[model samples]
Target chain A: MGDFDFSIIAANWRFLAEGLRYTVQVTLTAMVGGILLGTLLALMRLASLWPLRWLAAAYINFFRSVPLVQVILAVYLILPLLLQFLTGRLIPIGADNSAYFTFTIFEAAYYAEIIRSGIQSIPRGQVAAGYALGFTYSQTMRLVVLPQAFRNMLPVLLTQTIVLFQDVSLVYAIGATDFFGAADKITQRDLRPVEMYTTVAVVYFVLCFALSRLVKYLQSRIAIIR
Target chain B: MNYHWDWLFFFQEADDGLMYYQWVLSGLGWTVAVSLTSLAIALLLGSAFGVLRTTPNRWLIAIGDTYVDVFRNIPLIVQLFLWFFVLPELVPRDIGLWMKQDLPYFVTAVIGLGLFTGARIAEQVKAGINSLSRGQRFAGLALGFTEWQTYRYVRLPMAYRIVLPALTSEAMNVYKNSAVTYSVGILELYFQYKQIIEKTSQVLEITIVITLAYFVVAFATNRLFAWIEQRSRVPGMIAGGQGGK
Candidate 1:
């Protein structure tokens, strides 16, 4: 305890900030990619086609049921072998692939469930109204249904973003220097576990608090629209 | 690169053939036991907080809000680390020293998972209670039930049924989240699997086994939750009262 110095934090702030940039970038990229993939899965599940429905259901069930850490680990371990064989090249993606793929696929599975539930929560009459107006099924979904469904989903999506943001820390396990990873290195180097961990916790708390407040604000705005 | 069928030999003893399957079984037992114990704690604490959040007292509401906020915002891994590592140090000197030395890793993991998931359950329960009709509470009071009795026998039972879906999801999530405790070195399935993989270099086989184990646990949980939901469902609430669709 006596050996610990607050001065070290003052000096290493830049290093921590650099780590924070990587962490935020990884989270944002994953959130965008995951939401896109998740939306596709949600649409596939909603589709009337049998094989697509089965495939979507299986994907959601398997991914949602398994632990995210396990998913991250499995992809980190196995993706390189599969991708390289398929591409016939030692693609640079796998070399630092841990950072990119882990966040994207893990967040995608969760977002798929979120979007599916959001779609289901929309009243059935809205779709009936679309059909009554002579719109085709796909046209109704695009024109009438999804807009309202997405509004209902806004709050849940924000909540899920916070969850994904928090999970970005796990990138460290597979060897990406995320915020937690940066703190881990410092802790190991300095042997000041308490101070280092507390700093990490404080950073996480601030970011998450801001996020929830934004969600609350959006909820009110959406309510006004309703 | 022909795979050997004799690979199964590594799992058995060379001569007398005593399979140490008992270790895997015991590990699974601990996993289930931990999950159940945590679920119990989560349900009990979540109920208490859920009720407190609705209490008339402003201070209790504030306390409940803060509890939910802190636990909900932080990542589970960070919370686990805090509970397992920093918490002991924060305790009063003698007890802190004792806890630091005396508490087993498994027990700590259970406590951490329970407290964290309990926070989530509290919000779900509170939301369920708020969604109930005010007339029911009025009726309970008119029937000469006290406040506590009104809550326990009247509001809570109905709220529990209403929140069955959310609560079931939370319980399943709690089971999955329990796996994170492996970070703290609890020999739950994942941690042990890691050790096995490192030793044998049979990553694919072992990972397949682990994934299947997780799926079975999840499937069984979903079935159980479905059964409970069916039993607790309101008499008239199925399919929004329009059956035979």
Candidate 2:
């Protein structure tokens, strides 16, 4: 209790910052890729055809129910093997590069639901009005419905992104050095569990807390826009 | 790497006197234990904090809001690591020793998962309470109920009904999130998967089995919650005006 050292964090702040860079990278990749893929899936779930609906539902349900750590592990092991079989050699996405696509694929399920709700929130008459104005199906979705849905879904999407950012820490299971994993490595080498874990926790708390506040603010502003 | 499927590996015995299938079951048993115990804690704390958030007093609401914000914002993996590693060091000397040496990993995982999930449930419960019409509160007051009494009787019951639908997802999340405990060294399903993979060539098979195990638990949870939701339907009330869900 007497000699808590703040100097370890200061000494290794650059290393930790590098890890934070990777964390933010994975998060942004997942966010952008997930939203695009999720929007497509959401449309499939709402498609008039039964097979599209079932396929989307099945994909969404399986991902939603499984533990993300397991998914990460699955990616670590199986993805390389899959690429090997597919391309005649392991294309070597390895644990680190794999984390990017792994998260994007997994998070698409959650984003699908959010995007589905967002798409649903748009009035049917808006789509009908688009069609009436000589718009095709994709045109209405691209021009009128999706933009409005994106705005309506912004806060929820951001909230889930906050969650995805927290989840990016789980790549530690595969020995990838995201922010949390970076702290873990430092803790291992320095034998400073207290300093390392506490710093990591504090950083996460601050980042997530700030994002949540932004969500609240945006939520109010978005609500007023309608 | 050439892949071969060996489904029969599940029937083989490990040195611990349990077969692979039984080991899988034991893993499942632990997963269920973690999920249920944490869920119990989450509901108790969640309801408390949620009610506090909805209270007319600013202090109470702030207290609840702070709790939710602190817990929810941090990842479960970090919280588990903190409770398992840092907390034991932070406590008083003797208690810290006990935590380090004597305390069970399972208990630590449960506490970590519980507090984390409780924060989420508190948000759900707060939303449930706030979504109620002002008339419900007025009716409780009109019935001569005090603030606490009103919450205990009128507001809570209907509020819980409204939130039941949402709680199903939370219930599933608790189970899914229990997998995070593997980082803290609990012998849950994922831990079992690691153990089995080390001993077998059926990595894909066992992975599939683990995925199925989770799917099965989730399926059962969904069915159970659906049954409860149906049975608890207030008949022209639960859907907030429409017929039963």
Candidate 3:
């Protein structure tokens, strides 16, 4: 520890910030994509035909069962090969653009189940009341039930977002030069693995701690009795 | 056909792809080993945290809160990298060098999974404990049970029953996250698939194998947990109307 130089991090602040921007972009894109996909699956799982419900279940189970690393790896590595075999030419790729796509697809699986549980937590009576008022099932879900379900889900949803923020680091596995990747590169180049990695870890720790605190604050403000 | 699906290529010794499938089996073994070890570690720490959260002590509650918050927010892979690569570098020079040379991959994988999944199990366990009535605790006290005894007998069983589903999900998550071990070169299932895909360009076949492996493991594990949940139901809870078939 005493032998480690702390000043390298100060020197690399701009590079770190660039990495942070990419991390933030990936996190935001994946979260939004995950929520939309999640909501659709939630609705399908609830009142859709048996086949649709099974399909929804299978999607969640498959995604959640496999490791996110596997999912990310498959998208970046294996999918291209499979596609190249079908098509005449291989897909051209840019690092960040391809990375964002992989992250969204990877995160969508868990988020779908989270949303489904949130919807399931809603009372059956409320849906029946909406129907009694002559609202179609979709209309009732959209107008009344989903809003309440979202409220019920807000705390867990926030927690999931924080998880997503953390998961953005995994993009480094596929060559995206995100914050963690930058730190790893620094470690490799400078032979100061401890200093570089610790600097990044502290940065990650501060961000995650702040996010969890924010979630708690939000939960208190919008406390649901149930 | 420009792209013939040579399924027979996989079964022949002349084809250089058989080694990749063997790697997948080894990777699967590592995944299972890491999952089981981490599950044990997570359960122990989580149960202690669960007890603390329900205790009358304020500081203990704060400690549990801090633990869960810190670990839950960070990505598991970052944690793994920090544990395997960085932590060793920061320790005493002699000890650090020794660790870098000697630390087992399985040990690192378990620590990674345990720390991440423990935070989740702690939340589930605390929720389980809170769902029980105040009267149950009082009843244990009235029956002359010690604090530890009360926990061992009255509190934990019901709490386990209450949080069975959540624990099952966490178990699955830990199993899935174990694949992150590949980045540190743990050679888990995904690692095997990557090697296979790279070697023979049988990307679809190997990808399908990994997917099927996960599905089979998950389904069997879920069924096992469901059976445990059924068996662990409180006497009247299942025999009476509350339990679903």
Clashes of 1: 0
Model 1 lDDT tens row, A1-30: 444467777777777787788888888888
- The prediction achieving the highest TM-score against the true structure is 2
Would you list the clashing residue pairs of candidate 3?
A: none
TM-score: model 1 vs. ground truth? 0.90
| TM-score of model 3 (first chain only) | 0.92
lDDT of 2 by residue, B1-245 (tens): 58988898788889887899998999999999999999999999999999999999999999999999999988889899889888878889899999989999988889899999999899999999999999999999999999999999998888887888688889999989998898888889998987888888577999999999999998898888778777777767736443233
lDDT of 3 by residue, B1-245 (tens): 14445554445442444555566677778778878899999999888887888887899999898788777766787788788888887778898887788878778778777888888899999998998899989999899998778889998888888888888888877777877788887767877777766667766667778888877777777787888877777776642223234
Q: Is candidate 1 or candidate 2 better by DockQ?
A: 2
lDDT of 1 by residue, B1-245 (tens): 22223446246542224442444455567667778888998999899999889877899999988888888888888888888666666667798788778878878888888889889999998998888888888899999998789899999998887777788788788767877777887777666565555555555666677788878777787778778777666677752222211
lDDT of 2 at A75: 80
The lowest-lDDT stretch of 10 consecutive residues in candidate 3 chain B is: B236-245
DockQ of 2: 0.79
Model 2 lDDT at residue B84:
85
If ranked by lDDT, best first, what sequence of candidates would result? Answer: 2, 3, 1
Candidate with better DockQ, 2 vs 3 = 2
What DockQ do the predictions score, one after another? 0.48, 0.79, 0.60
Any residue pairs clashing in model 1, and if so which? none
Q: How much is the lDDT of residue B234 in candidate 3? A: 74
TM-score of 3: 0.90
